[model samples]
Target: MERLQKVIAQAGVASRRKAEELITQGRVSVNGEVVTELGTKVTPRKDKVEVDGVPIDREEPVYFMLYKPTGVISSVKDDKGRKVVTDFIDSEQRLFPVGRLDYDTSGLLLLTNDGEFANQLMHPKYKVGKMYIAKVKGIPTRESLRQLERGIMLEDGKTAPARVKFVSGNKSQGTSIIEITIHEGKNRQVRRMFEAIGHPVLKLKREMYGFLNLKGLNSGEARELRPHEVKQLREIVEKNKCN
Candidate 1:
């Protein structure tokens, strides 16, 4: 037997924290009996569990890739009254983002309730690479690009060297699109890197995280990841040691 919240999470009902909320609210029951206590235990296979009077199913895990749009915060909640990423999802299971994308930035974001999966993707020591397309105010000089390739001293310290390339630019218009791949997960790292070189990023979007891409997914839309896709992601994470 396991704790009720763990059972709920393992059954894909919600994240462990949200499951505990449901229990406290008297929304979860076992065998038709309300169980509002936090540490109540039950056998998932032997006892019938329900949330809001609906039976919970123990199915395969769910993973989702969402094309995040600008203006949506990446967190689960914002005490400052800003809209959050969860507002875009309508799943019965409580899910959280694997990492974060700043409110003004947009692109591929992963959502899952599996804590282990989330941990694997977020741990920086794993060096999981993420690719981004950045639009900057000025066309970066080759020297500036070289500086980025080597490493830049930020307020935090010198950043790790990243793979940087010039995709295209309109020098006449003083704007350029550059592709960058970095293994570290720093707060506003990409933007800061360009800003340090006097090329303030006007827009930024992550195109890929590790081996996962945002192909065919439109902004604000999401879908469950295929089993093969999940396997590929796991393999990539393991191979790259992203966590």
Candidate 2:
């Protein structure tokens, strides 16, 4: 037996926090009885759990790594008829992107039906690094790039310290390519960070998430994550918790 919110989250109904809200709002029921208690525990195998009157099945979790192309939405569905990341995969289980990539940004995206797994990875405290290869306008000086390494202030707030490296540059063309790794999931963060340094991003593509990369996959292609890969990701999250 486990906490009701945890069970709901593990079943991919919602994140544990959202599950708690659903419980308090009287939207979650256990065996035909409305259960509004926060810490209620029930046998998941025996108890019938429903959210918003719809019973949730404890399906086996599925994970996929997709080479998300630029112009694809990192979502299960889109309202404006735009192509979504999930459209590239074939899966019966309801899968959602663990975290979102901007509609115009591309590369390494993960889709999964495990809410608990998704929550842990997406949580700010986890510190899972996401690396991006960005081609920006003007070449930034080392001093300017050091600001990013030391955490620069943004409109939202000061950003966390990031790992920035100069990959290549074209002094004649006034363009440069840099690799940046950040753990935060702020909206358009990579682009904004470069813009703040007076080097607006001309192109951006995520190169890695934690240790996972788009090693063999082509753009718009996807593959199931091996069991060990999933375990390694969980281990990374756990190690961060210890720190």
Candidate 3:
């Protein structure tokens, strides 16, 4: 017998942490009875497990990298009928975005049916850096850029120090392009960071997540991750786990 949440995660219904929430919320059931305890365990072969009254089938995991387009939601489903990241890929397994990009933000996004892998990569303790390029409303001076590099205060709290690079600026247009790398995953963080420094982002695109990038794919396109790439990702997170 294995932990119920583990089985649920392996079945790709949700991440292990999310499975725990579903269990505690009384949304999971084992053998026709609702399970609310986190410690519940069962045999995947004998016990009939269900999430939201739907039986889950354990399918082999799949991973894909999407050059997500703007105006698309980074989710499996959107309540308002918006296009989602999963809609860009054709797959037999139920896949979900690793973390999230805002509805208007576009660029490299990872999707997978491996809940455990997704959970590990998204965990704050891993400290995976995401790099983004943004066109802001005003040119940021060296001191303002340095303030971002040294860490700045936001409504949520003070952000961690970031790697900020000034790309270019158009004095006449009153705009500048800046590249920044950050480890935090706060909602609308990139936009907020610039806004706090008096230069709100007018356009933004995520260029990298860890070492992954949108090399050959165009917007709205996706490709399966190579086995070696997946192995490298696992190694990266595992190595971080040891530190």
Candidate 4:
């Protein structure tokens, strides 16, 4: 038997967090009995489950890679009247983002209902590297690059050292595209780091997350992950356990 939330998530009914909310609201039932407890357990293959009076069936796992566009919030909901990331998803089954990309930033974002998988991706200790291509307002000097390599102090505190490199760009135009790789997922980290150095980021795009990339997928388009791709991703997460 697995946790009810896990069962619900595996069935693609909703995210584990949202499944818990459904349970709390008395919307979920197991074996024809309403269950509202957070820690309730049930067998997905044996027990019957339903949400909002609609029966849920076991479904094959689904994984997607989306090339998120800017001006959309990463969250499932926004209080200030803004479009959410879900608006871009047109799947028949329910799915949610594994992690997040800020509203102004864009690029590869994964969506899946596998709670265990999502846990591995979002857990801070994993140290899985994410690469970003950033265009900033000014060209960073060699010394500035050194400071970024060592790490920079944000409002929260000194950030972990990141891999920063200068790519080909026009210096006279006061703009440069630099590649940055960081394992930590702080709020607006790339932009914040550049701002700390007086070179604010003009545009940001996540080129890759761990082993996943946005290759071939057009902006605002999404595609299901191939079986081998999913297997490789799971292996990557397992090999790099979050400490």
Candidate 5:
């Protein structure tokens, strides 16, 4: 048995906080009766939960790593009807993406039905790193690279420090591939980071998330994260919380 919000979030309908708002807004029901209290506990196997009259799915905990393809938005569904991350998924576990990749960006994206697991990974305090290889408009200068590595100012604020590697460029600065790793989860951060330095990203592909990377998978393909990989993820979360 678990709290109502946890069940709703694990069902992939919304995050735990949003689920609480649904409860407070008097939108959730249990066993055909309205349940607005946050303390409501449910035996998922026996209880029925409805959000706006639609039954929430109770599925086994599942995790997946997908090599997101270009032009696919990383989301459960797009109101505009554009192709989304789930369009690459072949499972029926009611999973949702842990984070997002822009419609034009590509590479490593995770989807899962485990809400707490998603929370641990997305939380900035966990310091989960995201690594990307970006093809930018031009190679950045030494000072610009230094600024990026230290932390650059964006309108949202100064970005967290980043780890970057690449050549300053020869004659192919316009086609330079810059490798960057950061622990921040700001919106379109990598693209914005490069743009701030006058070398706007022409293409961006995430290659790693924390210790997980897209090695065997290709664009648009996905695979279940091995048990050991999941264990590592849990460890990362636990270890960080302890500190």
Candidate 6:
């Protein structure tokens, strides 16, 4: 027997933290009885689960890295029938994105049914850095660079200090290439950062997240993570478990 959230995660409903949310919201049922407490546990072989009225059960976990493309939403389903990240990967098991990539942006994204793994990576306390290559309008002045590096003021709050560099650019093209690395995962943050400084992003691609990168992968391609990579990720989570 395991904690209800753990069992729900093992079933690939969502991350463990998300599973807790579902439980508290009364979306989870075990053996026809609603369970709203995190301390609830069950024997998978004897108990049944229903999340949002759909039967759920434990299955072999799956993990993959997808090079998400523009026009594809980072969701399990879209009400408007738009293309989603799952459409790029063919798998029988249910998987959810660890984090999100905006519809207009493209690059490395992690998909998995392991809720604990997703929670560890996505939790802000870990301070995982995400790097992006952005093409934007005009060259950012030294003042603007300082603003970004020092922590730009956003509606939510001041952003954390970030790393920024000018990759290449010229006024003739009316665009410039710059790379920025940030720890915060605000919605459309890279684009909003540039737009905040009067330079709007023309294109954006995530280059790296923590140790994950897009190497030898084309747009819309999905590949399972290697055993060593999974081990390394678990180590990261365990190392920071106390913090």
User: Which candidate tops TM-score?
Assistant: 2
Q: Count the backbone clashes (under 3 Å) in each candidate.
A: 2, 0, 0, 0, 0, 0
Worst ten in a row by lDDT for model 5: 167-176
**Which sequence of candidate numbers ranks them by TM-score, best first?**
2, 3, 6, 5, 4, 1
RMSD of every prediction: 5.7, 1.3, 1.5, 3.2, 2.1, 1.9
| Model 5 Cα lDDT, one tens digit per residue, 1-243 | 899999998887777877999999999999999998999999988899999999988777889999999988888888999988888888878878987888889989999988767977888788888999998886677788888999989999998889999944546445688899998888999999998889888889999998998888878899999999999988988888888
Q: Global lDDT for candidate 6?
A: 0.88
Better of 3 and 5 by TM-score: 3
Tens digits of lDDT, candidate 6, 144-169 = 97899999899988888889998898
lDDT scores of the candidates, listed in order? 0.86, 0.93, 0.93, 0.84, 0.87, 0.88
What TM-score does candidate 4 reach? 0.80
lDDT (Cα) of model 4? 0.84
Winner on TM-score between 1 and 5 is 5
Residues 42-87 of candidate 3: C-alpha lDDT, one tens digit per residue: 9998999999999988889899999999999999999999999999
lDDT of 1: 0.86
Model 2 root mean square deviation, Cα atoms: 1.3
| Of 3 and 6, the candidate ranking higher by TM-score | 3
Residue-by-residue lDDT tens digits, candidate 1, 39-85: 89998889999999999877656688888999999988899998888
**4 or 6: which has the higher TM-score?**
6
CA error at residue 223 for candidate 4, angstroms: 1.3
Off by over 4 Å in 4: 13-40, 48-57, 76-82
Candidate 2 lDDT over 46-157, as tens digits, reads 9999999999999899999999999998877889999999899999988889888998898999999898899899887999999999999988999999999999899999
Model 1 CA deviation exceeding 4 Å by range: 1-60
Q: Which stretches of candidate 6 lie over 4 Å from their true place?
A: none
Flag regions of model 3 displaced more than 4 Å: none
